[model samples]
Target: MTVELCAQKAAAAGATYFGVEYYGECYWGNSINSASTQQNANLCTSYCAGNNRQACGGLTGQLGLYVNPSNVVPKEVGSYKTWVTQGCYSDSADARSLPNTYNVPSGTATTVEICLDAAAGFKYAAVEYGKECYYGNYLSPSASKQDSGCNMQCAGSPSELCGGGNRINLYQNNAYSQPASEKPSVGSFSSIGCYSDSGSARALTAGSSTSDSMTVEQCVKLAGSHKYAAVEYAK
Candidate 1:
């Protein structure tokens, strides 16, 4: 593509910078950081696919970077319907405050809207480490509220706050409706008792599988298919 076309696309997406690489590949970003360095103009010898007279980039390590003249500022996260801040909470790799989902499908630069959309079905949604999005029906028992520490800027919208290193800026969707718990049974297998589990050391490590809509019967059937004597389910 031509430089103008790439710039237009980046500007339309509210990007502050755009770069052309490997002839027709276009990349967009909100900021130009240390990872991007200036190179000699002569190194960019590859002709643009749309306009042969204009050089796009080089086949080697070179990029034709340009700033978007439009300078359209990205929309920041604000008050969402039926959603209110639940305050900052403690989180950890081993024991997360919201442990259901780690991040959204597109796990790049994260914003409050992105996290809330990913967690639409859940009661709580949290953003952490500037870019991480998490969802859960209930907060972990180990998690506790913190007075301060949720101060990191959002990766997608710098005007919004995402969370701190090990803290999560939690939000609750008041409109959420909790689904009924499933009571599944498989053949003759039944749950023996409640047991504790550790992420660092799994109780059953031979083979494992996970499903978003997993039930006890599904887990038991899967284990039976694999000739496993025991089945463990994690919610």
Candidate 2:
């Protein structure tokens, strides 16, 4: 690919540094190390795939590196219009502070706005390990606020701190409204209970369905029509 195209893609993904190598291959990362020292510009003699006039990289390990011009590191990601910072809190791999929902997309950088948008309907939103986003209605009983601990910068906005290892930078959404719930009944299938599910490991793995305006009743009816014994609704 061309240098401009690679840089655009990297910038869109919130990457700070990007490089083009081997004519068409593009690479992206947050930091540049000593091993990636600048080489002679003439060595990058290979032509770009998209633009034949431009040189991409050399046959050797010489890379044509470039910095994303659009990348802007925000000073703080704590507060939004209706969302306020809830201070730094402790978390664990076994028990998260906000366990209602979470999103961790691999290789995709994270920002405060991204986390807040994902947790829009929830009461709480938490950013952990710089790249992880978690949402919940209530904090875990075991979790507690710490005087100091959150030290890691956000992956997307490096100037803004997200959270340290096993820690979470929590935020509270004041405009949250609880969803209506009633005893779901569809052809003898009654409501069982609420269960936790994750992207890696699903509680109900077989014959799943999705809907834009999903409700407990619709999910139960869909499952009942399909002769499924159980149904799960996730927002």
Model number with the top TM-score: 2
What is the per-residue lDDT of model 1 for residues 39-76, given as tens digits with 9 covering 90 to 100? 66777779988889888888897887776434533323
Per-model clash counts, in order, read 0, 0
The alpha-carbon deviation from the true structure for residue 51 of candidate 2, after best TM-score superposition, in angstroms, is: 11
* Model 2: lDDT of residue 102: 59
Regions of candidate 2 where Cα sits further than 4 Å from its true position: 1-76, 179-235
**Residues 92-120, candidate 2, lDDT per residue (tens digit)?**
98987877655645534677777888888
- The lowest-lDDT stretch of 10 consecutive residues in candidate 1 is 69-78
- Model 1 has an lDDT value of 0.75
In candidate 1 the C-alpha lDDT for residue 104 amounts to 47
Angstrom error of the Cα, residue 215, model 2: value is 19
Point out where model 1 deviates above 4 Å: 1-78, 106-108, 181-235
